[model samples]
Target: MIFMNMIFVDREKELQTLMQRLNSPTFELVIVYGRRRIGKTSLILRAISGRNDSVYYYATERNNLERFREVAQRKFPEVRYAREDWESLLHFLRDKVVIIDEFPYLIEEDKSILSTFQRIVDENRDSRTKLILLGSSISVMEDVLSYRSPLYGRRTASLKVGELKFRDLRHLGFSVEEAVKIYGFAGGVPMYLTRVTPPFLDWVNRELKRVDSFLRDEVDFLLRYEFREIGTYKEILRAISMGKNTLAEIRDYVKVGGEISSYIKKLERIELVTREVPVTESVRSKMGRYVIRDNFTNFWFRFVYPNLSLIEEGTYEITEGEYANYLGHVFERICREYVRDRYRVKKVGRQWWKDVEIDVMGLGNVKVAGECKWSEDVNPHSVLANLERKVERLGHTVDRYVVFARSFSTKEKMEKAELVDINDLNSWFMS
Candidate 1:
């Protein structure tokens, strides 16, 4: 139904690159991919917009060659294709720019599509034809670039479009708090953010938990298309979203424990979940935790998926009843992102040693330790004091202490630490 709001914020670098490719004298092979609803198609369309000379064809599951002919006819009605095969059709557009969205669909339908593209790209190395391919399936798109694939090492340029950050939501005209609270649920997915309306809680009730909601079916649509074992992946996502982060913890939470590592590896490959070690620790550290990096994905498993019955009966009255706890976790991510965004941090992530867990840590020229509180009326002094105690347990010297909260009990400044409230964050958002 094309429900995306289509505000088309950000993607300046990607847009610039795409525009630059159009001017290149040689043949251009561009690959753009990301998870669904991440604006890959939008970016391409914007690049090719207002240019009748270019052909933008969406390849479908069945009769993609026929569909290709139909779209090509719109652009070149007077020209006739010599043959019905993809090679003959694509060769017809040799001097033109052709973009095939959802190229993975064509790949699934015909396994020989890779060789077709490889032959075209090889036969047109010196030609000025620009071929841009895009896909929503991470694994399949990545495979096209793999050493084992026929089209490997052929792309002139590639871009993995990602989610927007909390700071990037300023165009919505919401207060900093409102944007951040919305980010806690919607994350940075533009599709979900566009559905957010006034009266935040009401938007949550209407847009999130409803049976017919696009978001309600989003995760399933994504997983079903990407993975073969959807049930196993969902259980793992639910386990991680519920705080079963450790391998052992996730293994215990999800009973079908054949090889949790392989499943987790697939999720990591897709960028749906991440395995994080303490900022100060090595990548191979045993204390690694698998965290869902996507806010909307986590929201689905944590709240929406588990409460389907309530949605089915249309009696889902409560919205964000337990959202505070979720935000408690989300606020940590916000502070960590802020530290990385605002400060020159060589390392930025959470740190934990046994029972002592620091919410945010940024190690650049100086080690900065931060405590994030999603509650009201925070005491910076006490938070810093407690944070100091926790930092001491790690046997390290922290050059500064920073506290981020919804609101502070006092504005009194300290020489060693800085207190940042929603207003402070809002200023950063604007900056």
Candidate 2:
């Protein structure tokens, strides 16, 4: 019941594309899926805002198909024929727009629903119907609507929603520092952003106090709902959070004694984590490492989850004290992620050599390497020295060496190297 401003950012192009498809003559069937809280529903709602077309938006639950059909009937009253059966319901809807959220739940409740949908879509291929199925469970959505599934070739288009980019925060009225703090805590989830208030410290304090908060419970909920092997997933996340990057370290930490390839595959399927090999020509080498894909999950696993007992006991003071000690390092990491995201969006995909890893490296026609510092004062000499060492190790000259910091270096140092101040990060990212 909380009323907050709808801070919609980015996704403008996606919305326009969906609208264009909806207006086309062909019968459009789109599948939208993503991890929970990534704003699939929000994006769809925003696209349909102020539209006068016949639209029926139904959210599926764990109940039986009869109940779902009843709800669907309530939403779409134009069709005189109402039925509790799935095939009948699909057959009745024609020349209208239908959106079913959490589509996987409906498929799971009735296994034959996919085949029924395929038949209906085939029979009505000439009719003007725009149907969209949305789901938050990554695995279920992929398996059900993927090219290998029964409903494979039926979909006209598919979109996988993801987190808002750091560059989008400028539209939400957040300074670079504030955006970094929020992104580190919320991982660009729109729902999580609504829970955060101004005066960032206040939000942090409140978040640290709630034991049953979304931040505390999301990991378990996602694992239980999306993954079958919860124990293996937890072990892998714990290993990564504790700074175990290499596959060997993670396998040893899991203590499976043998290669944990199955567990790695499981984690990757759910998109909760990723395996990063050195950006090199050798793809078969076992030199890759695993890392958590989401920033908030990484922060939660590394800091908040480890101190659950303190959080539950209402020891806010103690938690805050400890957080203060490690906050600098956390912010430094966030800055690095921001710079890397900018590099990625700009089509810079280069990486440092295996022996020398820069905090952030942008590779395109021109190479850009960066060092992120979250200190009050940035020592330009130290950054330049590191860049020199990195260049020497790579045995190639980089096109640009940039330094990102809270505050710029002294006047003389600014003239020596490329410096991006914290305040200018938004512009830098947008560029």
Best candidate, lDDT = 1
lDDT of 2 at 68: 54
For 163-205, candidate 1 gives per-residue lDDT tens digits of 8888778877778888877888788888778778756678887
Clashing pairs in 1: none
TM-score of 1: 0.96
lDDT of 2 by residue, 318-379 (tens): 34445444445455455555555554534332255557876656556656666767665787
lDDT (Cα) of model 2 = 0.70
Which 10-residue window in model 1 sums to the lowest lDDT?
1-10
Please give the lDDT score at residue 284 for candidate 1: 95
Q: Tell me the alpha-carbon RMSD of every candidate.
A: 1.9, 3.2
lDDT values, one for every candidate: 0.85, 0.70
Predicted structure 2, TM vs. truth: 0.88
Residue 261's lDDT in candidate 1: 92
lDDT of 1 at 141: 94
